[model samples]
Target: SQKTNIKALLASDAIGSTVTVRGWVRTKRESKNVAFIALNDGSTIHNLQVVADTAKFDENTLRNVTTGACICAVGLLVESAGSGQRVEIQAESIEIYGVSDPEKYPLQPKEHSLEFLREIAHLRPRTNTFGAILRIRHALAYAIHKYFNDNGFYYLHSPIITGADAEGAGEMFRVTTLDAKNPPLDETGSVDFKQDFFGRKTNLTVSGQLQGELGAMALSKVYTFGPTFRAENSNTARHLAEFWMIEPEVAFNDLDDNMELAEDFLKYLINYALTHCADDLAFLDARFRKEEDKKKKEERAELGLLDRLNFVVANPFERLTYTEAVEILIKSKPAQKKQFQYEVNWGTDLQSEHERYLVEKHFKKPVILTNYPTHIKAFYMKQNEDGKTVRAMDVLFPGIGEIIGGSQREENYEKLMARVKEVGIHEEEIWWYLETRKYGTAPHAGFGLGFERLVLFVTGMGNIRDVIPFPRTPQNADF
Candidate 1:
């Protein structure tokens, strides 16, 4: 019995040959004499059409092959008599492996809203939208590893549980074995972390950049692909309590080199998706256009999914200093009309609105904003000659504001220590990190890319939770 998946059978030249296929039923329509079943195996977004004669199977067997039911169909592949699909399976024999009751099945033939799908996360993958997103997600991740490996970068696995808060934001999920109701208390009447499993305090790592930098220092170039956690209680569409991050660190690379690396890496990922996931991308492109059609005329986007991806890949990203961006935003009509929620200033951090304006409105392309004010940036960033600014860069895309944030690291021991002390970050916590600067520290740079954000951007999904399989938001942790 030569069994074949729907995807392979659809693509094969053996159209006149018989093959056995297994998949879940997406929809089934019955005529007086024949039944047409749409079957999806999760190998592709498009379903394989199966035509079964009522005379070939018992009535009870025909009744069991409903939506969401599992079945094995032995059929001959032939050119489709239908309009939409290229091929269809003419079933000679059929077996119902599992029957799905039509009344209890959550998924139906009708298109369900994304909001409704989120409630049934377990079964959402059976839908076309999520299946396409997941396929693209896998392709993108594979492309990332291939690009890094081909570029002489080593894959570095960083610790998920780290003692040091890399971002210094103090927003971390504590990984503790201590009792929640009544933990060990010190003389200060506080819950003592010293008595915990790891001896001292520990929490989930917010970013692997610090550990990635350490690997780069020894191995020249390294990249980390791992899950990261944050305890931030924000319930926005973009914020996630736990998420995966891609961080690449390179030694002997300055801010300019860092920008080039990030740009090339992102382009590779986009191009890879286009080449490998053509069918899925096409499906998503059509889906995006339909979504756009529903929007008000003025609210719709300028470019569709494919055009946007091609535009980003073909064009060079606009480069400008953060100071220049702030200056331009300050002089823009939004600021003049008092339309901005957050006021634009020289030293203040740029909000999502300001970044979007610079990217989507002003630049009309991907823009790299460099040399940010030191006070607003991380402590490890190299201090610029201006004393007030640091060598930092943020890659802002058209719809997704800041996709990447990176900087040339400070190799100077004293300067790094001073910045650490200035920021009130305890030096003892990062003593090993300081030692790298003291001994044979070269000018290094790295950046962190939120994987979910990238997935959201590529899949044209509105919410970050939709791209990730099982989202961990502030209040919701359901699988």
Candidate 2:
């Protein structure tokens, strides 16, 4: 029979039966006459303990069974006499597939800082913290697709390279294969973009919302789950040069409908993690508490990991206009005491401090702030009749400031084009996008959720880079 994964073997009820398990050695201990190896296969957090009598194995084989080594252990499944585990393996025979040098292996049977683990990202998955985070990340992703599909949303694949700038932020990574030292210049002194590979300038997509809207126009509801790039030279804990985004666009949906969908979708994802990733979550929860214990007592979280997630799914998100939020913040102790770094203002963008205050301190729950100032939002957001704000909304979680940002799109062709032009976007570049509104365009809305931020919130990871396997930040693209 084939070797069983450690996760299955640990959960198996077939005690006294023979089984073979293949995994990496997390830890090994020698008790003079017997050896115990903690083996993990990446299927689950718990390791299957394999007890081997020293007399049954050769000296060379026992010596090679060190941390980070790969091995195959054929043993009898027996009830564990240990305190932590229910079952373990009584080794009949052991095969050392690969030996890891104790001095060469960066990972050992010790606690390592997140910063050190990032330096060795290729081997970080073997760590308990990262393993739990990745498992939870997978569960969240599965829940995202399942929720959208069950609701009849078509999965749309947006182009990785695009000419359109969805956010109009002008912070995009250009994709060009033009020779830097050679020819290819127009009559003007500037390099000719027309002579480039795409026959024009092109770059990595900043967002898939624009293409998602195109799909939604036909499919009624569509979603895009893929990588998005930004060229912003920010080194914040929250910013990433390249990260995955989940953007869902729905036609014939108003701002309220969009809010409802976002709330439901977020709840579904959190609930799914709670149900499917219980063990991983529990491990991460304890890990979070250990980290929190180092902080000041006043800085501790009010709710634990599972409680926070359950609170989000069980309770309704508090909804209010951005203007109203500003009014509340202006009168807040932080503002009144002048403790806020950014002063509370009616028209300016809300900073992370302000967002966290609203969700964590003021509301003490998830908040959905709507009707952001038009000048701060993207051009696609529907402008209000008062010409001051847009139908934009941002869903702020307790720990994560802004988990989702979405809005009702401008269906009016003339208004959208005027805004596009006012924003200095080349009119000819997005003629196809404009044509959608020119044709039979219906009211629509969508929002984007940063996938890594969700993982950070769920796993209680402090840094965005810690949750992602290979983080691409400013000046850091290490594998």
Q: Which candidate wins on lDDT?
A: 2
lDDT of each: 0.91, 0.91
Show where candidate 1 strays beyond 4 Å: 334-337
If scored against the real structure, what TM-score would every candidate get? Answer: 0.98, 0.98
Candidate 1: give the clashing pairs: none
For candidate 1, what is the lDDT? 0.91
Candidate 2 weakest lDDT stretch, 10 residues: 333-342
RMSD in order of candidates: 1.3, 1.1
Name model 2 segments beyond 4 Å from true. 334-337
lDDT of 1 by residue, 257-276 (tens): 99999999998898998899
lDDT of 2: 0.91
Candidate with maximal TM-score:
2
